[model samples]
Target: MSYRHTLTAFILAAVITPGAHAQSFDPGSMKTPDGQPDISGTFTFRTLTPFQRPQALADKVALDTEEAAQFEASERIRLNRDLFDPESG
Candidate 1:
C-alpha cells in the first residue's frame, strides 16, 4: 500500500505485461486479411545473396566498393531467368 511498493509493482507489471502475451510473426508465410497467404513485397529484384555471410567472406566483415560491385553483379546473374534451367520452369 506504500507509495514505493505500489510504484515498484506498477513499473514491474508495465515492463512484464506486454511480454506475457507476446505475438510472434513468422515472415516465411505471412498472410493476408482474407486468410490467403500474402506473397507480395515492395521490392521485385529478389537477390540470391546468402542470409548468412558466405564462408569465402567469413574473414572479411565488410566489402570494399570494388568487391561490393562484384558481389552485386554475381547476384544479378544468379537471379537471371536466362541463366536458370529451362526444363525446371
Candidate 2:
C-alpha cells in the first residue's frame, strides 16, 4: 500500500477502536465514600503462608516462634530465584 493510504487507515482505526473495547459497569455498586470505584477486592494478596498445613502441623492453628523461624528459612531458600538452576527455570 502507498504510505498515504496506510497513514489514513491507521488514523481511522485509532479513532474508531476505542468504542469497540468499551465496558459497562454499575454506577452505584462498589463505590467508596469518596465515589471512586472500590478496587479493594481486586488484589489477591501474595504471601509465603502455606496453602495447606503440613501433616505434622495439621493440629496447629498457628506456628510457635521457633517453628515459624525454621519455616521462613526454608521458604526463603525455596523462593529464591537466584538459587534456582538456570536450566530448571
Candidate 3:
C-alpha cells in the first residue's frame, strides 16, 4: 500500500524466491584442445550375483552356510575334473 511497505515486500520476495544458475552446452559443439571430439575413459563393471539363477534354485534368496559349502564343493569338483582324469591320448 505505502512506498516503504512495497519496498519491504519486494525485498522479501527477492530474498525468499527460489533461484538457480546452471549452464547448458551442445554436445556436438564441444571439442578437445587437439580439435578432436571430447570422450570419456573406459570403465569395467562387475556384480556379485548372476542376473538370473537356475530355475531349480529360484525360491532361494541367499545361500545358507551348508548350501554355500555344497555349491563350492561342486564348483571345485567341476574345475578339477580334467586334472584328475588321466585317460587322455
Candidate 4:
C-alpha cells in the first residue's frame, strides 16, 4: 500500500510540473491606467560621435562641411589604395 501511494504521488507531480514553466512579458501590450503607455524611465542615447574630435580636426569642436568632405575623401583613398594596385606578373 505504501509503494502504491508513492507511485501515485510521483505520477501526479510529473503531470503538474509542465504547467509551472515561466512566461515571457510583452512590453508593447502593457499600459498605464490612464491609457498612455508608461515611458518615464532613464534611457541611454548613443552616437557615432568620437569622444574627441579627431586630431585631423586640429582643435575644432566639430567638422565643417568642407572639413568633413576632405576627411571622408582621405579615408576612402586610404582604404582603396590597395585595390587600385596593378596586377603583379
Instruction: Write down the TM-score for model 2.
Output: 0.37
For model 3, how does the per-residue alpha-carbon lDDT over 1-89 read when each residue is reduced to its tens digit? 69999999999878766442234556766678777997666754343343568676789888899988787666555656776544741
TM-score of candidate 1 on Cα atoms, chains taken together: 0.38
Q: Which of the numbered candidates is closest to the native, going by highest TM-score?
A: 1
Q: Give the TM-scores of the predictions, in the order they appear.
A: 0.38, 0.37, 0.34, 0.33
Question: What pairs collide in candidate 2?
Answer: none
Model 2 stretches astray by more than 4 angstroms: 1-46, 81-89
**For each candidate, C-alpha RMSD in Å?**
11.8, 12.6, 12.2, 14.6
Q: Tell me which residue pairs clash in candidate 3.
A: none
For model 3, state the Cα shift of residue 54 in Å.
2.6
Off by over 4 Å in 4: 1-53, 85-89
Q: Please identify which of the two predictions, 2 or 4, would achieve the higher lDDT against the true structure.
A: 2
Question: Counting only residues 3 or more apart in sequence or on different chains, how many pairs clash (N, Cα, C under 3 Å) in candidate 2?
Answer: 0
Q: For residue 73, what is the lDDT in candidate 3?
A: 64
Off by over 4 Å in 3: 1-52, 85-89
Please provide, for model 2 over 1-89, each residue's C-alpha lDDT reduced to its tens digit, 9 standing for 90 to 100: 69999999999999878866565556777899888988786554367787778687888888889999988877766777578675854
The per-candidate count of clashes, in order, stands at 0, 0, 0, 0
Model 1 bad stretches (over 4 Å)? 1-49, 81-89
lDDT, ranked from best to worst = 2, 1, 4, 3
